[model samples]
Target chain A: MGIQNTLEGSNTEIPEIGALDVDKIKQDFPILQRKVYGKPLVFLDNAASTQKPLQVIETIQQYYTAENANIHRGVYYLSELATQKYEHSREIVRRFLNARSLKEIVFTYGTTDGINLVAHAFGRKFIKEGDEIIISEMEHHSNIVPWQILCEETGARLRVIPMNDNGELDLDQFRNLINSRTKLVAVVYVSNSLGTVNPIKEIIQSAHEHDIPVLVDGAQAVSHYRIDVQELGCDFFVFSGHKIFGPTGVGVLYAREEILETMNPFRGGGDMIKSVTFERTIYNDLPYRFEAGTPNIAGVIGLGTALEYVENIGYEWIGAHETEVLQYGMNVLSEIKQIRFIGTAQKKAGVISFVVDGVHPHDIGTFLDREGVAIRTGHHCTQPVMDHFNVPATSRASIAMYNKKEDFDALVRGLHKIIKVFS
Target chain B: MDELRELYQEIILDHNKNPKNFGELPDANHSSEGYNPLCGDRIKVFLKVKDGLVEDIKFTGSGCAISRASASVMTTLVKGKTVQEAEELFKRFHDLVTQSPQAEVNLEELDKLAVFAGVREFPSRIKCASLAWHTLIAALKEKQEPISTE
Candidate 1:
C-alpha cells in the first residue's frame, strides 16, 4: 500500500531534486540520435523493446573482449572469472527485485520463456484435473497462451477476470471467480497494451486469503517503476531484459525460494543437474535447477549493467518525468476531434492507445513512420483485449524516461497529418 | 515522399471512402476470405460466376485504406471479365505492386490498377494492396480454404 503512495506524487516541479534531464538521458542511447525518413527519430515504441544505453552496449562488448569463456564446471582462470561475472549478474537481478535469496532468481531467455518455465514445471507438479486457473482480460498472449496450453495438458479450467470499459480489472468479479477449485491466479502488473497499472499488492493479498499462489507478468512494469518482489508479496514475478534497456535474449524470473524448491526443474541438462545416472538423475540447487544450458553470458552481463544504469538514474526521476510526458501526450492527442482513446484507465503508466474515427491503425502507423515517429499498431499481443474493445487494432505510443515533451508535439503533428491525409 | 503521395493517391482515397462493389453478394457461386494476420486486415471476396465469366464481384471487410481501396478497384475492373482474364489481371497487378521501386511499370496494361504502383516503395504495404487480389484468385479457382498474406 505504501508502494502506491510512492507512485502517487503530485506533478509539482522539484528543481532541487534534479528533475530528469531528458536531453542528457537521450545522449546515453545512440539510436535516439539517428535519423529516420530524413527526420529526427522519435521513438515511442518503448513497450515493444527499449533502445540499449551505452553502458549496457559497452558491457556486452567488454564481456566478449575480456571474459569470453563458458561458465560453471570449468576450473581454468578465464572460466572462473566468467562464472564469477555470470553469478554476479544473478546477484544483481536478486537485488533488483529484492528477492529473499540469490536462489530465488533464475535467468531465462525473456518474459515469455520465464512464464513457460513456470507453466510447465509448476503446472505439471501442482495443477491437476478439475483445478482452475484465473487470468485477466488484459494479459498479453504470452501470459494467456501458456496457461491455456497448461490447462489443455492438465485438464484444468481457465477462468478469465473481466475488465471494465476503462481497461481496469473488476476485482469483485475476480473475487467471485475464485473458488475452492482455483489452483492459481496469473495476471499482469502493468498491461502492455492498455498501460493500466493493476493494484498488484491488493491482488496478491486477495489471492493469499484463499491460499492460492499468484504469478505476475512484470514485463511492462520493471523498466518504468521500482519493483520490490518482497514488498509486492507475489509468488512469482517475471520480466524481460530488452524491455528494460538491456540486450535481448536475457530475462529474470523471481520466485520465492520455497516455491522454487517445490516446483520441478524446468529443463534438464549439464548445469541443472548435480549427478545423472542411466536410470536416475539428481537435480541441482534452487537457481541452477531452472538454468539448464550454457546461458547468454554476454547478454547477462549487459543486463546487469542495464539494471545498474536504471538504479543510478533513480526511479523517482524516471516516474516523475514519465508522468509529465504522459500528461503532455494525452493533452496534445486529445486536441484531435477524431481521436478516441481505447485505454482510459484512471491509473496508467506511460502509454497512450487510441484510434482515429475514419483511419485504420495501420494507416496511422505508416503515416507517422514517414514523419520519423515510430508507434506500435495492432492488437499488441493482447488480442483478447482488442476483442473486448471490439477494435481490429489501435495505435499505441508508449513513453519512456528518455522521451521529451517535444516528442509528444511531433506525435500530435503526425496525427494531424494523418487526419488531413485521410480526410 | 513522392512515393508516399503516389501510394495514397486521390483515386485510392476516393475508392476507400466510396467502395463501388462493397458488401456481400447473395447469389455468388464462388467466395473466399483474405486475411493479413500481421495487421488483422480481413476481406471477404464474393463473386457471381457463370460460364467461367464473372457476372458480378463484391467485397466486404475492414482494413487500411490501401487494402479497402484495392478491393474496391479490383471489383470494378474484374466485373465483366472471364475467369482467365481475371487471372491474368491478378498476375499483372501483383507484378505492379511487388516490382522494384525503380523498375519501369507498363501502366497502360494496368490501367486504373496502376495507382497501387507506389506500394513498391513501401514494401510492407504491398501485402495490403494485394490481399484482395489474392482472395479473388482463390475465389476464381473455387478454393474453399481462405488465403492469407502471411
Candidate 2:
C-alpha cells in the first residue's frame, strides 16, 4: 500500500483546508498511479516541470481531434472556430493574471522567450549607453543572460541586488542601486532555486519612486499563488505554462498595454503585420504585434483548461495545502543531523534545497531514483545562487498542490538509505 | 537493484575515502583540466614524463565517489607504465566501462581496475569514470583547452 493509504488508515487528521482532498486530487494525475522499479513513484520535482492533469491532456487531444486549424485569417468554418478558441485562451490568461485587457496578454514560447523579447524590443528602443538594469543575485540564468546580452548590445551596465545569508534579497541595497541611470528593474517574483517569494509589490513601489519600470519574472510564482498584475502595478510580468500543470511551448507575457504599444517588435513575420508592402509594414494590434507567427494553438487551449482547473480548486486551498507539505518536509528532513538546509528564508514557497555533509547531490539523486522517488539535483539553472552558497549543487524537493506528507516521508526514507550506503 | 551494490563496491569506497595521488604536482611538466559541467566536477591531471615513462603523476579535484575513486585507481595503475602502454590501457579501461553489462570482461587483464566494470550498468556515470583518463590523454597531447564532458 502507498503512504496515502497508510496515513488514511491511521488516527492522524490530514489537516486539509476546505475540499482539498489530496487523495482524490492525486487521482486526477494518471502518471502518479504508476510504479517505478516495483515501488510507487513519488514525484517531488515540481520546480522543474509539473505533471499535466487529465483535464489539460484531454483539452489538447480534443483540440487536435476536432478543432485543428491555423488561427486568424482563415475563411473556412474550422478556422473561425480555431480562432475563437485561441482568443478565448488569451482571455483566460488575461483573467488569470487580472490584467487590464486582453491586449496586455501576449503569447510566447516560454518565460525565457518573453524575457528575451522585452530585453530586445524594449531595450533597443529606450535604453541607451551608460544606462543600468538592476537584477538580483538569486535570479535564474534565463532572467540574467538576456539582460546581459542587452547590456552588451546597448553599452548599458547590469547591477545586482545582493542577498542575505538566509536567501532574502537586500531591499535597502536594491533601493541604493536605483538612480536616474537605472533604466529598468528586472527581478524574479519567486526564486526557483531558493524558493524565496520576493516582495514584488514593494519592489515595484520603490522603482516607481524613481519613475523606473519594473519587469517581474513570475515563472515560479504563478503556480504557488494568484497574481494580480493590475494591483501589483508592475509594468510587465512573465510566466510559463509547463510550470503550472499546462503544456510546454506556451507561456504568457503580461505587459501594460501602453508599455507594449511603445516597444518595437522583437520578431517580424506574417499575421503580426496589418499590411506589408516592399517599402513599409504596418504592425497589428497590441498582442498580435508581439506574437509574430503561428502560435501553439492546442497548447494555448490546454493552458486555458489548466487555468480553469486551478480556478475551480481556488488558490486559498492550494496555498494552504502546499504550505503544510512544505513545513512537514522541512521538519522531517531536519531530523538528519548531517543535512544542511541551503535556503532558510522565512517567506519561502514549497522548495527545499539541502546538501548532505559528505554526499554529492548527483549520488543522492541516483539513489533516490532507485527508490522510485524523484528529485532535482543541480544548480537548478541558478548558478549564481549556488556560487553564493559555496556549493556546486544541491538536492531540491519542491512541492505542488498534489504533493502530500507521505511524499516527504518517502524522500526522507531514501535519504536515510543514502546516508547508510555512504557511511 | 543489485547493480547499485556492484557500482559502489568496497574497493571504490576505500579508494574514495583514501584516494591515491590526491594532490597537485607543482613541478610537473604537462597538465590538463577536465570538467563535467553537468555536475560541476572539476579535475586537473598532472603528469611528469621522462624517457617515454611516466615518472610521476597526480590529480587535484572534487567529485562524487565514483569519479574520485576512479581517478585514484587510475593513478595507481598507470604510475610506472610507458607512455604508449598508458594509452593502450586507457583504451581497454574505456571499453571496460562502456561495454554492455552482460558482456564478458577479461578480469585478469583489468586486474584492480575490474571494479569499474560495473559502471557499464549505469550509463550516466561512464563520463565520471572516464573523466580522469580523458584529462590524462589531454595532458599527454599537451592540449591547452580544458576538456569538458558536457
- The global C-alpha lDDT for each of the candidates, from Candidate 1 onward, is 0.89, 0.89
TM per prediction = 0.95, 0.94
Model 2, A263-293: lDDT tens digits are 9998999889999999999999988999888
Cα deviation of A149, candidate 1, in Å: 1.0
Residue A212 of candidate 2: its Cα lDDT?
98
Tens digit of lDDT per residue, candidate 1, span A1-423?
122123221211212325557787888899999999899999999999999987788777767777789999789877877777778778778888988898999999999999999999999999999999999999999999999999999899999999999999999999999899999999999999999999989999999999999999999999899999999999999999999999999998999988999998888888999899999999999899999989999898789878888887889989988999999999998988999999999999978999999999998999989999999998899889989999988999998889999998999998888788888
Q: Least lDDT summed over 10 consecutive residues: which range in candidate 1 chain A?
A: A7-16
Query: In order, what are the TM-scores of chain A for the candidates?
Result: 0.95, 0.95
Steric overlap count per candidate: 0, 0
- The CA-based lDDT of model 2 is what? 0.89
